[model samples]
Target: MAGKQALNIVKIKKMKQDANPITVITAYDYPSAKLAEEAGIDMILVGDSLGNVVLGYDSTVPVTLDDMVYHSRAVARGAEHTFIVTDLPFMTYHGSLDETFRNVRRLMQEGHAHAVKMEGGAEIAPTVHSIVQAGVPVLGHIGLTPQSVNQIGGYRIQGKDEKDARRLIEDAKALERAGVFAIVLELVTEEVSAAISAEISIPTIGIGAGRGCDGQVLVFHDVLKYTSDYREKRFVKTYANIGEQIRNGISEYVNEVKTRAFPAEVHVFAAEEGVIDQLYGKGKAESES
Candidate 1:
């Protein structure tokens, strides 16, 4: 399989015009990052989704900048070849441009992310611009943003009606104007998703948005069946049912352990008499203990 392409805002900018689809996936830990990189994932988002998936939180709103830093650093270590984008958790980008820049720097300088992603439109244009000016690339997220879950209500499709669609299109434009590398469209109608993709100068990476998007992103847990929350969304096409497979495999192991079928010689190591004697007079006391 093709490995991850060299990832940066410049390549993504080119992809916007070239219409090449980018692939993004969230990875919170080392093993996931290593496998995602090896599987040729184009980008690894150290998204605040980890607050829910890894930490068992109900929403990402509670994830702090420190939390993002810790997870981003871990993902960065395991994904040397993949471009890693760390999310600016909920309140990290608020109040002042200076504050935003400081948080972005911390995530980049300490967390080692190539870029940062934030959710907003015109309201956040200034912050996005300031971050880019400060030398950190920004990725925009629009339409059904999770960070605004409380304000916007629950998770649902966005940009369906005419007003909402227009707003989404405008949001994409605004993000492009703010000099974002790409914009993520979440839970949007296919028509609106397509329209935004066509209107934007930056690549549109979709989640619940449809096939016309320039790229697609999914939480790692949702993709790999580690998500134990709700069932799959309409847009999610499961590539594997690893959950059931893992469950069955573990169940078999449990049954085997109960029946004493696990330690069937191949699973344990044995030593010859003379070699054992050399190591211990009869056997090591540590072993006996």
Candidate 2:
């Protein structure tokens, strides 16, 4: 009810061409997706960050294709009008082309996602190409891919130097050629992100990559401060303190219950006058009254 219309590949590409900044948020469940839709977010990503935020995992490397599909289905049901992109979790796309296609098919058919996002650079372009050719839209990701965090030696900013910057640029261009409608640049240096945005025709959705991108994305929980123990990140701008509010509200409920202040007269149902007397002994009820 909040958004204008669902965005498609053509419209998304047009936004980049028109220099319109697209907005995206990660929503892993029904209520989160509903909130994102009601807020009129342009796109909803069923990100594998759910491993950390939703599933209590240490990193996204532990997330699987099934986890993505389950969450994507919930998000799709809630945000029916918004474009939904589901992540191909670790190892789902690293196999043979046929295996990758099967994974992509499950995300599209069972997950009900409009598109599937894969991490890596030019190295994975051919796989992206094959998915696109199979009639599935692909979103590319680069710069600190979480699925390969261990390989990359942890979540470090990428493209700080000349050679790394060039590689990112090449990755972006190759993704474009491979037919990805957009690419996500995560934790890349601002200069390199801007350069990639300028160099490529497709929109670049930035997380920590800076303002030069055609669009931006952040996790729903991160934006709303929904995770009580989540450490503050440099790139995140929390707009609300819902976690504290929840804690306070629940604490109040507990105090009220302990004090017998809740379930007062207004919260109870009255029995007929004689019914109570009959339930207890009549003489006892009369004497008590």
Task: Report, for every candidate in turn, its global Cα lDDT versus the true structure.
Answer: 0.87, 0.93
TM-score of each: 0.90, 0.95
Query: Which tens-of-lDDT digit does each residue in 103-212 have in candidate 1?
Result: 99999999999999999998898889888887888989999888999999898789879999989888889888888988898999999999988876778899989988
Model 2 ranges off by over 4 Å: 271-289
Cα lDDT over the full model 1: 0.87
Error of 2 at 152 (Å): 0.5
Candidate No. with top TM-score: 2
The parts of candidate 1 lying over 4 Å away from their true place are 1-5, 228-230, 272-289
Write the residue-wise lDDT of candidate 2 on 53-155 in tens digits.
Answer: 9999999989988999999999999999999999999999888988998898899999999999999988998889988998999999999999998898999
Range of the 10 consecutive residues with the lowest summed lDDT in candidate 1: 1-10
